[model samples]
Target: MAKKNSATKLFVLDTNVLMHDPSSIFRFEEHDIYLPMVTLEELDNNKKGVSEVARNARQTSRNLEEIIGTNEESLEKGRSLGIKGNTHVTGKLFLQTTALPHDLPMLAGSKADNQILGIVSYLKNIHPDRQVILVSKDINIRIKARALGIAAEDYFNDKVLEDTEMLYTGITELPEDFWEKHSKDMESWQENGRMFYRLTGPMCPNFSVNEFIFYEFDKPFHAIVRKISGKTATLEIIKDFINGKHNIWGINARNREQNFALNLLMDPDIDFVTLLGQAGTGKTLLTLAAGLAQTLDKKIYNEIIMTRVTVPVGEDIGFLPGTEEEKMTPWMGALEDNLDVLNKTDEEAGEWGRAATQDLIRSR
Candidate 1:
């Protein structure tokens, strides 16, 4: 594989890339941008709908107009993308005004994908001294670009994390001897049934409110940072959800992380909570159990409103004939499966009783 140069390179933007983020052109910083005429046509065609893609298309058109309007440079010679407000852009933007010297295997119809690929090939050929790459959000276009010997990349400007592993877990594991070193000016107190501790240390500044931190000693001590004042941080010790007395829906937390999660989930004071975990980590099970216990048993809230991204795991089931809840049933198999486990916790609630409980929970 050829190493990518740190020098300013030319990036050819696909219509989808611009629609994904209107500011993507400026996001390149010092790099130049090339927009194919076909890309502009596609953007114009898509700029007339009410959907999110349409709105993004319109925004991209407006941004392009602003950039072009601010620059007085000729179209053929290229124009500076930077305007008065955004003087950080040091690269120029060019539009494809002339025909390219290439031809692809003829297809049945006039496809936009082929036109974009041809433009990338043309840019790479003309700019032999510099690297010319195609940037798009479409997987198929990127694959086709690579097949045609053009360097292609995804539009990473709008991505939350460059790598999935870099996502914040909300839990920070402190060193085993963390408490020993940081406990010098520690202050402890019990407030309204909850325990709080204040410790001053260099690590205090890195802490954020509602962030879980734990120290591993003979036993794990887990707490959530409730407040931070300069070098001092007040951490509230997470409740022991594993204790038999505090079990929710007959489920005991299996680990420190689970216990901490249960603490957040069951807390009435915490208006909203987000749980993140990989598959088989009991994320859904814990959340469902806590929601049921609070809404059904404790009567803390009127009802539980559960919804999730309807991303299909396998082949989609196409259209289903049912009401809203029924249509959403296929997407909620995990939730239903967890409820079944919770319903079976009470052995006294035999087959018929379990069915009744399941039905009642489902009705909610």
Candidate 2:
């Protein structure tokens, strides 16, 4: 492979990066990658177990073997990453073939991290015009590299979102003048007692299906985008679950957000729903209400199966004796509390009726 230009970066891989994601080699796109000898040694040391980390290590070894092949000459010169149909990777892969001096002070020379850092330092010196950066998942390694005046960064390919604010909230608030701006050739009708509107405007193309849109102006409109074709979009008014008449299993939504969540949960067309909120936000309550309404009243589903991670807050109370359900009973305090609230929602139901309702819920 020919030498890359100064604009192309050379990334030094740490063992933890490969162990976290084996395909990271192909993820750098046009940037070249370098693997230190100590990184390969660490991969070999960790490839014995059946755990996920071990599996990744073994896979990385396989990928390297396939890239290297039987050619020894290309080992000294960098191998093209695009050799094995990896056309997306336009850069080269370099392996540490010769030993470099590791005389950096304030770092233990015997540590694998230090060895990788030494390779990075040497590469930076050799490639004066090119940018050589160390990509690592370990924070301490990155900090040490920066202290030694080396460029280092975390592997960002695995992160879905760098900022939490970028996450989609599944709901969007329309501008106050949304109706006026999008009313051009707007069509409205009722089908099966559900009101729907079809409108064309500049913003119609940006609407996505199943996304809830609400306007809290004069009419306080709330609807979900049902379809989008060309520059036209169709929205159907969502059911008002906050009304007592439209309550789900004797539970009415206390707020608009909870109503939207209940709408998603009760929609048979929607196969999956994810709710995000802080504690005491009624997430569990709304979910249980919708699930009970669908499973019991509507007969839409046979049962509801709820599971949560068994992680404890503090020191764990180990070794509970019983069957699977019994062992999990200690962690079901939240479920019990929520069920008590749901059972009390039926004001007409007497104490015996509430007990019988609880029995039915537990049976399912």
Candidate 3:
């Protein structure tokens, strides 16, 4: 391939970039697509996996196969008609593939990433005029690309906010008046402050009885929202879990932290919650109370699995071991302490402690 002026650009795609987002190829409608022979090999290896990205990659490869076939010369001349002329399967639409330049760089000794950068270096040497832009989602790939004097960028198709960790906007504490006026329907609260910016339709949907809404203006309080509540509940409600007496000496779930707690607690998909806390953060009590209300009172799930990781202080408690149940006793003993407080606090709460505890473990 002959090197031309910097009038046109050649795009070198990293395998991860393609995998990260399959729409990558279609996104760059104005550039010639270049995938190193090694990248094709990598993609072939990735295709055997059962991931959605693999399937999408396989489909994209098949489409490209029909367009470019195996003709190196046709690709070289930019004569291979594809979904478009501006888009080439082998990067030669604009002085596409060049000969390997100097040997690959000596970074990270023998990483696959380094080998990929080596290929990029060779392509850049052959087509120095056309901008050899390496597109990859891997930070290391872009780092190596730039280190070797090749222009590199993240795959624009790369994503964020796909999982629970990302979309969690945490909790939002509205003033009492705003919350009372808080309608799940955005149209009802159009004049309200920026709280509606994060939400698309309604703030909290009707399907949130198991979920929560915390209120903390001058004081901190919580409400548990029942999504898809049954006939027993006369009120369309999300009750708060707050008892000033029950407050841990130093426990604070305020503002965004409060929001995150509710976000995780009220999350419909997450049936279990485990809060790890130090001395005073009402962790143990809040857990027991919320759990009992949901399992028995509110009737969300059939049982509440309340247990904790017990790192024994020092010497081992002498053996009284039998089955796994007996073996768990030493560890389970500490969790019982919290339940004792809960049971002692509410006299009418029934014989829930041991019964719920046993049923919870047995159900598991």
Model 2 TM-score (2 dp): 0.93
Q: Write the per-residue lDDT of candidate 1 for residues 102-199, one digit (tens) a residue.
A: 45774234588888787678767666778889999999889888887889999887776646578777889998778777899789999999899999
Report the Cα lDDT for residue 130, model 2.
93
Off by over 4 Å in 1: 1-6, 20-23, 45-56, 70-92, 97-130, 137-150, 159-163, 347-363
Candidate of highest lDDT: 2
Candidate order by TM-score, highest to lowest?
2, 1, 3
User: Per-candidate TM vs. native?
Assistant: 0.79, 0.93, 0.45
How many steric overlaps does candidate 3 have? Answer: 17
Q: Which stretches of candidate 3 lie over 4 Å from their true place?
A: 1-11, 15-32, 42-73, 76-119, 122-131, 135-144, 153-240, 243-291, 303-364
Query: Higher TM-score: candidate 1 or 2?
Result: 2
Each model's lDDT? 0.84, 0.90, 0.56
Candidate 2: the clashing residue pairs are none
Error of 3 at 249 (Å): 18
What CA root-mean-square deviation does each model show from the true structure? 4.8, 2.1, 10.4
Which segments of candidate 2 are over 4 A away from where they belong?
71-73, 82-87, 160-162
Predicted structure 3: lDDT: 0.56
